[model samples]
Target: MHKKFMYICFMSNSKLYKGSLTTIILKLLNENDKMYGYEITQKVKALTKGQLKITEGALYPALHKLEAEGLLSVEVKKVDNRLRKYYKITENGEKETTNKLDELAEYIKTMQALVNPKLA
Candidate 1:
């Protein structure tokens, strides 16, 4: 029973992180002009105190998808003989971020109301 409960908790947390990946990336770019993949992953882990972590496998795919979608622009830089891709938000990305955030906020409020009717 305990193992099942733990597994469910882990899955739930992973789903939340996956759902927020786009928002996380956009918000990070919004705060800074640009950031490399590793930096973005570390920032999210630090900001969430390790509660939220982005696996490279998942992060790269999302970044690539965002780039393909025209929401992100990338610049490559050489550091220590290795190339790093730094991402920044485009103008359209900035506008989209604002709209998405508002929608997420409303969704959160509605969920909270459902969870705790008195709080709403």
Candidate 2:
């Protein structure tokens, strides 16, 4: 039963990602000057009260993809005797983030109307 529940949760999260993971990541970076990979995952989990978790398996790839697209800039810094890579939004990333946020808002509004239509 626990496995079943976990599977259901995975399915739902998978659907969420199908729509908004990239936009969500961009939004986070837009709010902050810079963030590291692990920091991003922990911040997201805390903000969502553990409802949403971005595993490293998924997150690193997304970060790499964003960096490749020139939407994110990467910097490596030495922290606690180890190198940590941080990501910051570029000028293009800021513009892209704004556009993506607008698109996501429209999507949410559409979903709300479909899920609970209001009588006019």
lDDT of 2 by residue, 56-77 (tens): 6678899999999999999999
All candidates' lDDT scores?
0.83, 0.84
- Residue 16, candidate 1: C-alpha displacement in angstroms: 2.9
Model 2 TM-score is 0.84
RMSD of each: 6.1, 4.8
lDDT of 1 at 26: 90
Consecutive 10-residue window with the lowest summed lDDT within model 2: 4-13
TM-score to true structure, per model: 0.85, 0.84
Sliding window of 10 residues with minimal summed lDDT for model 1: 5-14
- Kindly provide the TM-score of model 1 when superposed on the true structure, using C-alpha atoms: 0.85
Score residue 89 of candidate 2 by CA lDDT. Answer: 98
